[model samples]
Target chain A: MSGTFYGLGVGPGDPELITLKAWRIISHAPVIAYPAANGNESLARKIAAPFIPEDVTELAIPVPMRREREPAQEAYDEAAKLIARHLDDGKDVAFLCEGDPLFYGSFAYLLDRLAGKHPTVIVPGITSITACAAQIGRPLAARNDILKVLPGTLDAERLKQEITGADAVAIMKVGQHFEKIRGVLTELGLAERATIIEKATREDERITRLADVPAGERPYFSTILIYQGSEAW
Target chain B: MSGTFYGLGVGPGDPELITLKAWRIISHAPVIAYPAANGNESLARKIAAPFIPEDVTELAIPVPMRREREPAQEAYDEAAKLIARHLDDGKDVAFLCEGDPLFYGSFAYLLDRLAGKHPTVIVPGITSITACAAQIGRPLAARNDILKVLPGTLDAERLKQEITGADAVAIMKVGQHFEKIRGVLTELGLAERATIIEKATREDERITRLADVPAGERPYFSTILIYQGSEAW
Candidate 1:
């Protein structure tokens, strides 16, 4: 019997944010896999550690975070093959992902290679965008409002145009590019309404105004959201 | 001593999609409030029913869905006053929401009145957008790809502008305006790549290519997601 491959999204930092379906599948799966880089622990596995069983087989796919600097094509290629072995033996394997699997998540790479060849299921998780919006205690957008999610890696000029055209904006992957992103928001007079959320839904979560966060190194797990038209506190 | 007010998102249609945090708070809450319309049972309340205690007090705010025919302000006002009484008595109240509460949810109206006056916390939920994307087994947007969330209620021209300007789009609230939205997607040559998902993540969920759904009444819990570069199945 060929086994099923489950792509489970364990959600953001908090373990409690994981859904019931994800928890159930994770706790009972015969084998599990998650992304790791440079021997660092996978955030997805950490968020799900409380629910994962004690005896399940574990595999780590070394997916480099900085894909631009170090291509990880060969690593993913090898990981998919190893995963196939477990499935061929009729052992179900659950691939854990941080956040929603298909929303800018690393799981997409694995899914692309495996979905076409086997029975696969993608279980969605809560997004950090919604988590940040929840932490802000304000609606991201209302009726007929436009929401633009632009990557911070975009050229500053294009970023500006996209930000200017939307009613609510969430800029992802805002690592060291915080200053440039903030500058664009400042130019658009949205600096005050903007919020920098780090590790949202976690115990040590920090929320600050864009103006207050110093221009320096930012945490890898961070996002900038602006609900324009509201006066800054 | 006043108690905290929790605005929890129970997630889309699947009961298991509710987060552990939401379940914990809802189960322990002294009073539970949810939005109901025209005597129809509240979807949020239904999603959380398995976790809710039998002895807990339930408050149904009759928020009419037909805002054009019957404004909902008066109903919300009355509900707020009733909720305030619970807060005034130092009893913790948990307000349940269908999707993410801060993302175009009915809970926003209550939060607008209670947020500043009382200590409130917003617990985010799994968005239907991400759920639908996961069901389709494709990335919503990756790398520098732009994601635009445009409401189907927008004027045809504005909806067209927003849809054309992004690499990926999720058209929400696709009720009676399905024809217009479908027309725009067809004009943009994206109909072949679009997927209509109803009640994602739940039993009896339906996923269909946008071009194949016959001309008929679309479900309110449905959304149309289009990944511009892909072909529809």
Candidate 2:
């Protein structure tokens, strides 16, 4: 029988946010596949440490994030080859991701290459947007409202248009684009309604109103939630 | 010491989808609260069976879905009373929800009443829309695209406006509203691009093109995913 590959979501920062399905799969899988930088430990693997069996094999795929295209593609290809080797040996492998595997997740890149060649199961987890919204006691969207999830890297004009048209917006991938996003929000009169969350749901999580946040403190993993209408409560 | 209350999201379906945080709270909480009707088993409680310990207390709040306003509010008042009783006794309670607790979840009604009186934590989960989308190998929305989540119970005109403005839409709470929603989709020229999923990620899950789904086979848990733009792939 061909070995199965499990794409498990470990959830946003909180270790206890991993799904029970993912926990079971992690416990039973003979090998665990994790993404990391070269010679660095896997964040997903470390978060899932509580439930993993001590004897499970670890397969580390170092996926470096680079501005250039060739290096990233080459890394994914190499990782796929390595995962295939374990499948050839008939060892079930579970690749762990921080949130939902397909929602702006890196696992999608690997799944695109490895799907159909092997049986795969994706276990979804709590996305950070929802967690962040809940942490701040606000609903992402309410009845008859529109929600838009935008990557902060988009051009300012496009981001402004999307934000203006949306009843609620969750801005993700906010690294170097923080200032641009802040500018767009301010231009659209959404500065007062927006809230920024850095490392949400983690013990060290910070929740601050957009107006109060300093430009220098923004992190890439952080998200900004903007609600133009009534408060959720 | 004051006790806490948790509105935990179990997940779309599949018992294993309960998050680690929810699992840990469910396992350790002195009292477990779940919605039920006429003494029937609670679906949320059933999904969380794997992690719930034998010794924990169970509080079944019968939250019947009734059209009568007085009865529904009464149920909420009574449920709050029971939960408050536990809190007064210094016992933390975990109230389980099928998907994310804040997304059209009845737990919100309870939270509105008890949130200030007691310590509460809302743990988010994977909503059915994402689960349905992932199961069908479809992206919820491409980069910078507009996405809307609307209840199928909305008037057709309102639904049409939201659908027309969105690059992608997930129409949820779709049971008897099937024909109405279908009509609106057809009128908006979105019928061809829609996919319907019922009981997503569950054992009896069904996914099909909207045009092919037979009438009278729809369930309330079903969701319709409509992609207004060309396929990203």
Candidate 3:
């Protein structure tokens, strides 16, 4: 019998956002897999720590983000090989992802490689956009409205066009692109309506209007939500 | 002291999808407010059952859907009055919503009325689109791709135009308009690329290729995900 591989979403920051199915899988799986940087603790593993059994074998696949495509591809290929070896040993493995595995998650790369060789199940979790919007006391979009969720990694012109066209927009990964995204929103006359959230749902969470944020202090995990309507107030 | 109003998203169906922040508010709030139909239990309240404390007060505000504007507006006014009465007592209240409170949620009606008078917090939960995509092992969109989340309530011709223009699209609230939305997808030559998910992530979850679903079995909770790119496969 082929061992099952579970791609579990641990949710955005808050540990309790994990689904019942994911919690159950983590507790019962004989082997647990988490992505980490070299010599770093896995964020997903830590979030799932309370549910993970002490007896389960823990495997950390170090996948460093690289500017070069070859290194990243090689890392994914190696991680798939490692996971395959564990599956061959007949141990059910649970791979922990911070949010929905299929939503900009690294697990997709591994799943593509392990297709048909193993049984896989994906457990969805609360996405960061919704979590951020919740903390700020704003609805993402109302009835008959359009919602566009995009990464801040896109170019400023494209981001501006997309933001201007959307009824509500959630720009994620607002790391270094903070100023660029802010400029785009400003150009589209949406800066005043935008809210910034950092480390949402966590104890250290901060919510502030985008116009109030100082330029030098923006964090990588921060997200900007723009509701392009006067009624948002 | 001013009483706080909580907009808690109960998630799609699974109780565990509710965030820890939402669970905390639901447990400690003096009153739990939910939308219902003539004293029926709210679906949001039921999904939140596992986390709601035994001592928490339950307040059901029946907001029936109506074809006419007068009845719907009247329902919103009545619901607002009930929530205001609880706030007058200086008691914290939690209003339960099934999905993200801001995403086509009826809570918007109450929020419009109650926000200025009370301190309101919105707790975001998992939306069905992400849940559906996860269950089917499909990506919502890739890097720099345009994703449009539309409602089936839109006219079929407009929906068809948007579907054709978007790299990926999620058609929501496919109730009486299932056939119309299906027709739009077909007209855009996207029938084979679309996937239908009903009651996603729930025990009753059903996923089918858009072209293969039986005509008579479509439900209100069903949503169609369409990705036009050939690379989606």
Candidate 1 docking: what grade? medium
Each candidate structure's count of clashing pairs: 0, 4, 0
Across A1-233, the per-residue lDDT of candidate 1 in tens digits comes to: 76899998888888988988888899889999998877998888889999989999998878777646234768778889999999989999999988888887777778877888889988888898998988888778765568889888887899898888687899998887888898899999889889989998878899999889876867567989988633211
Q: Report how far residue B28 has shifted in candidate 3, in Å.
A: 4.9
Candidate 2 lDDT over residue span B1-233, tens digit each: 55898998888878777776777788899899988977888878878888888998999999887532234677788899999999989999899987888765677778878988998898897778768867876566644455677777778887887677677788887888899999898887778889999899888888888888777666667999987643322
Give the distance in Å from residue A95's predicted Cα in candidate 2 to where it truly belongs. Answer: 1.0
lDDT by residue for model 2 (A1-233), tens: 66887888787878788887788888899989988877777777777878888887888888886543234677888998899788878888899987677666667667777777988778776787888878987677654456777778778997887677577788887877888888988888888889999888877888888888786765667999987644433
Query: What DockQ results do all the predictions give, each relative to the true complex?
Result: 0.61, 0.40, 0.49
Predicted structure with the largest TM-score when compared to the true one: 1
Residue-level lDDT of model 3, residues A47-120, one tens digit each, is 88888888889989998854322347778889988988888888888999887786666777787778668988
True contacts kept of each: 0.80, 0.44, 0.57
Q: Assess every candidate by TM-score.
A: 0.95, 0.87, 0.89
Residue A179, candidate 3: how far off, in angstroms? 2.7
Give every collision pair in model 2: A16-B20, A16-B21, A18-B20, A21-B16
DockQ-based CAPRI category assigned to the predicted complex of candidate 3: acceptable
